[model samples]
Target: MIYKVPFVEPTKNYRMIKNEIDAAFFEVLSKGDLIMRGQLKQFEENLAKFVGTKYAVGLNSGYDALHISMLAAGVKNGDEVIVPAHTFVATASAVVNAGGTPVLVDVGKDYNIDVTKIEEAITPKTKAIIPVHLNGRVSDMGAIMTIADKYNLVVVEDACQSLGGTFNGKRGGAFGMAGCWSFYPFKILGGYGDGGAITTNDSRVAKMARLLRYNGEDRETGEYYYHGFTCLLDNLQAAFLDIKLRHLPDWIKRRRKIAALYKEGLEDIEELKLPHFDTPGFEDVYQNYVIRTSKRDELANYLKKNGVEILIHWPKPYYSYKALELKDRGFPETEAICREVLSLPMNVEINDKQVEYVIKTVRSFFK
Candidate 1:
């Protein structure tokens, strides 16, 4: 039997909510309330409330969220900010753009920073740690925060993939000094276009970020604060995000249900390493439903031939690239996982039958 499953179909998700989206789309444009208007303010307020933070500054993209958050939290030129090597290059890019050197770290099987090894990597020049919450699972914030407190380092969470995720009863963005989120169309709380936000309880950090996102001009006083970048989240996009935000809780529930199905179907395969299940005190939102296997390349090929679309998060670690020139970085676990990690289709649009077909097809390959 032939089966068709792409990684994620954002169109399908959009179709399901077209009316609400159209209503929001038309409402924003008709009013000509573009650029940091009511919609943006509403979305920011709503996002902050949802993430349990005192502030949420909407930005053009997640990279800006990370970069602005770092600068706001005092990451300076030549300072070292630790990050897991396994995540998207944007995490490291944020560090570089903030004028800090990215100190790459390794990751565990859960696809998050290896908390046990973080302290060993700390240095006197280390100013912060950006524990990327990869694959919709939060890192061990307890360990991360402990290390940060010990070193007096800032904790800027790359919570892009873990919007609805939690660790130890705390939401993804809430655990850090500032948490950065992405609203790319693929994210759980995705928007129609590029959108992102920074969540923070620290009012000063929040204020600084707000200033930096615009031209460093204090809107209230019409005074220039500092030279900043033009990277504000679109008001229309914010309106759309506000609509999607209302549906996020239900979407997260469906995502978790999908994760459960994946775990039940694939856990028996000794060669395949699944992500963590309902470990106590963690509520993973299952952003991509990743699995690791030594036979990743072979399996990926077989799945593609049989029409089960798959993806590798990063074919190689960021530090492996020549442009960055950090080949000396020792991320043993990251080096190992680069050859094995695979992301299965884990979007809300996927039906149970599609998941079953994927599972059955994967089993066929192993046999």
Candidate 2:
């Protein structure tokens, strides 16, 4: 059964830029430079300029970005890296992939890492902190940065969900030692296929990340510097991303408009908790217009049955995963949020009629 409003529609977005994308494809095809060449270099430069970073290295996927960031940050076996317990598993798995132990911490009301709890979790072995900017909302980087400075810990930002989000007028990827981003089709700044990047002001970290993403080889000489993974972003995907980047500002503005509409329609419902779009010192891109309800499962079922497609950002917290060996360790806030949060149909392609239908359907369920 097809739903009236799908959670995301990358194909519709692709169609909007098909001509430009086709042109880019042919240009790259004509050049016959498939790997990291002109298109990838230009994309990296444009992305670095956009995010206010000194360097940006493109990779195959966001997981590679995070994993490469950890390696570049000097995270080694037996070292501990703090990560939010409520995020996508990749946030924590990156630590393990880099040979560091992931120390989980619960998130706060804003659905970001609770900086207050960060200090207690730090130890002699703690080498880094990976703060996930979940739902296109920048985490409290002001506090997280302070803590990192105090502990001399590396801060690798997971800005995959928050390409344009800003805090205190600073871009999401600008505050950390290295920022990892994703171009998964579902993300705010999506690509046609798997793509990712790491941004940083530190030249040393930038160099390491570049090497890590490209088999640790010297780009100019093609000499192997160290053992590394083959994780370069496709030149064609970079071209697609380059075109999409031009419209990101408008896309973010539209997402904010949709969030405003959601709040206007749902704010009065006592049982539902809407996202804090107007948080001081922060500008959210509304990557996923998530709302919380006590009757989450029932409401989701009702919406699905009625032709409105909805989803859960995550049905389980990171700590609850058996592979993490953290069951019963109790992250109450994370657990509660996992059970209640629901992501509505959010994307640039969603029309006003679809938005209103979602609103009406949600209100009908509560009534």
Q: Global lDDT of each model? A: 0.89, 0.90
Question: Candidate 2: minimum summed lDDT over ten consecutive residues — where?
Answer: 321-330
On lDDT, the candidate that comes out on top is 2
For model 1, which pairs clash?
A: none
Residue-wise lDDT of candidate 1 within 1-367, one digit each (tens)? 3449988787899899999999988988899999999999999999999999999999999999998988887888879999888889999988888788988888876778988888888989999999999889989898889889999998999999999888888899998889999999899888888999999999988888889889999999999998998999999999999999999999999998888898899889888988875457788998988888999999999998988889898788778788885534678788888888888889889999999999998898888
**Candidate 2 vs. truth: CA RMSD?**
1.2
TM-score of each: 0.97, 0.97
Query: Candidate 2, which segments miss by more than 4 Å at Cα?
Result: 326-328
Candidate 2 residue-wise lDDT, 1-367, digit = tens: 7889998877888888889999999999998979988888899999999999999989999899999888888899999999998899899889997899888888998899998999989999999999999999999999999999999999999999999899999999999988899999889989888999999999988888778778889888898877998999998899889999999999999999999889889899999999874568999999988899889999999999999888897897767667676534458888899899999998999999999999999999999
